[model samples]
Target: MLASWQMREGFLRSGRMATRRGVWVVALALGLAAGASAGEEFEGKLTFEVVSKQAGAQPVAMDYTVKKGLVRMDTKVAGMSNYTIIDPAHKKMSMVMPAQKMVMEMAIGSVEPPAPATAPEIVKTDKTERVTFNVVDATTLTLVKEGEAAGAGAKTYEGQQYAVKVGDRNSEQWIAKDLTLLAGFVETFKAMAQGPNAAWMKRVEWPGFPYRMVTKDAEGNVLSEMTLVAIDTKSPDDTLFTVPDDYKKMTMPQAPPAMPKE
Candidate 1:
């Protein structure tokens, strides 16, 4: 069992990006509490069978594990490794490579504070009534409202989409017909590439598995597709969020030493 403060700290540290990707594992553990509460506590195991394909080559299979809060991805691909850590609340995330025995930590925050506009865009399309906007640029679109359409059974956003679901406090969500992309989806990738909240105007692509992405290679070979398998609302064990006592603690890379004082 873990202490409450420790759990709170873990929650606070996990940022929007990490939580968006793996929150389902925890949500599965939490069960019904996930529905009634904004952010119900949770913890559980996740097994990911990832397949990647390039032009003419056959798809490659990779297995991954999500235990507690740690993720271990094993593959022979370059620039990727065997271990990673994600914290959603605080916008802090880290990755580790067992072969290199190295760790990288990054602090994540919004690239730009949400615009000062009080109201989101409400549009009444021929099919339905909804609210939507590109918060940072056209890349990050947030759907603030939705109503039924006459003939359409469901809606779908086809391009550059990430995970879909209602978000908790500390984050906003962009919704399309059948998907939800967390605010941190774009924010975290931007922060990792540039710097904390670094600003750029060009449209950047959304990464990882989201509802909108189609798994295809240049030659039109079908890779693997991700689908929403299930959802759980029950509250999970409070201890699921904590770092383990037996696991080794690794340090992130050190920044260059400050220049000697003049």
Candidate 2:
């Protein structure tokens, strides 16, 4: 684990731009958090700007709108504009490329994510006050990855993966039970290292979202981070989830490698 952390530290210190492409690895269902709470369900938009320090990496600003099982993400990257609509109810994701005037369709494996452990084993580590543009909410709890201490054998858990070369993963997040997004996000991902290429991948019993998440190499150097900029529960336009009449249907340019006929 020491060697792995050292390598990851070097990587982060180098700021290689190639890794920035992973910004899109967020959950296929970022907006799906059903059965979370009685009053938590509502439609609204979340706008965030993802900035990377990696060389040649261009910052991206995107908006996510959610209504029930539908989600629309409009993105602008490197002067190019495009978007995707994820329909969990039908297990379909639409990729709209305006330059090509085409809409690509792909099927997702699941819409209803695996429910998080009802009695998740929780181990608290640290706590501190967190702020968002002066909206302070200090009810914070930092979680620890049970078992597999640093310099020990590999950390084992369900769906753990290390793509583009693996590295030591020691993560902690500030969780709030009110958000109901942090736990589900963890349970939904790493169901096989499929944690959307982002470091916000660890699962715990916290019932809320993390306004601040920090992942470290074995040595604890910051790798990547995700900050919740805003949350609005107002319902969004229904049309955002629908493909336009003028869009031409096309097969996804890159499909998940087909399962072998076993």
Candidate 3:
């Protein structure tokens, strides 16, 4: 059985912005509204689907809601639902289990980016494609380069957000163009650089959210993947950003002690 931290580390470092139950949302919304209402936070809803051939895991839906730097994610276990909230500004993360009515929280530390200029380079291609899904019409877009992988079709604002439209049934987002939303990413990437994922992480250089990514193992077997399915831009209820009043706070369990190094 995989330990909790093992599972969570991937979700966190993989640049997850939010998630949910039965319809997982994976969003990274960085924004500056163009003709959009002022004081508008980058609210977004998305569904994430994961397929793994090696693990033989059933395709499960994870939903996400994101606004500003706050994220609300939902998941389930044994038919019971669990929710997690990540607040980058406060540097905290909490897990709430509805069935148990319990809430567990942990304090997180922030990381500094290597350079403000270390952002992704973008260039337009002649290729064009239409992307559509729930609530979003058939929006045509042009492919842009991020690095080796070239599959982003988005309309750009001078120095604001990128409204990406990619393929049918996939969600779109307004990825932040500034350094504000990169705090969590900075921490995750810093960890990746020091961890085993260093080489792989450095090679890709994905600037913002990845709407759809398919990862395969060395033997060419599909390891796992996460893709966007749905999206919305309306601000979610404020309650979604906090622990429910019905849930009680619970102390997190401590890890087992490490063995002596000898």
Worst 10 residues of 1 by lDDT: 164-173
User: 143-173, model 1: which lDDT tens digit per residue?
Assistant: 2223523232222343332321111101111
TM-score for each candidate, following the candidate numbering: 0.31, 0.58, 0.50
The candidate that achieves the highest TM-score relative to the unseen native structure: 2
Candidate 3 weakest lDDT stretch, 10 residues: 22-31
| Each model's lDDT | 0.30, 0.46, 0.41
lDDT of 2 by residue, 186-254 (tens): 332232123322322333333454444554566766565544455444567787788888976754323
Which stretches of candidate 1 lie above 4 Å from their native place?
1-49, 53-85, 88-91, 94-212, 254-262
Q: What is the overall TM-score of model 1 with all chains considered together? A: 0.31
User: How good is model 3 by TM-score?
Assistant: 0.50
Candidate 1 vs candidate 3, TM-score winner: 3
Native-structure RMSD, model 2: 14.5
The per-residue C-alpha lDDT of model 3 at residue 68 equals 62
Model 2 TM-score is 0.58
- Which pairs of residues clash in candidate 2, taking residues 3 or more apart in a chain or in different chains? 25-196, 43-234, 159-191, 159-192, 159-193, 176-208, 180-208
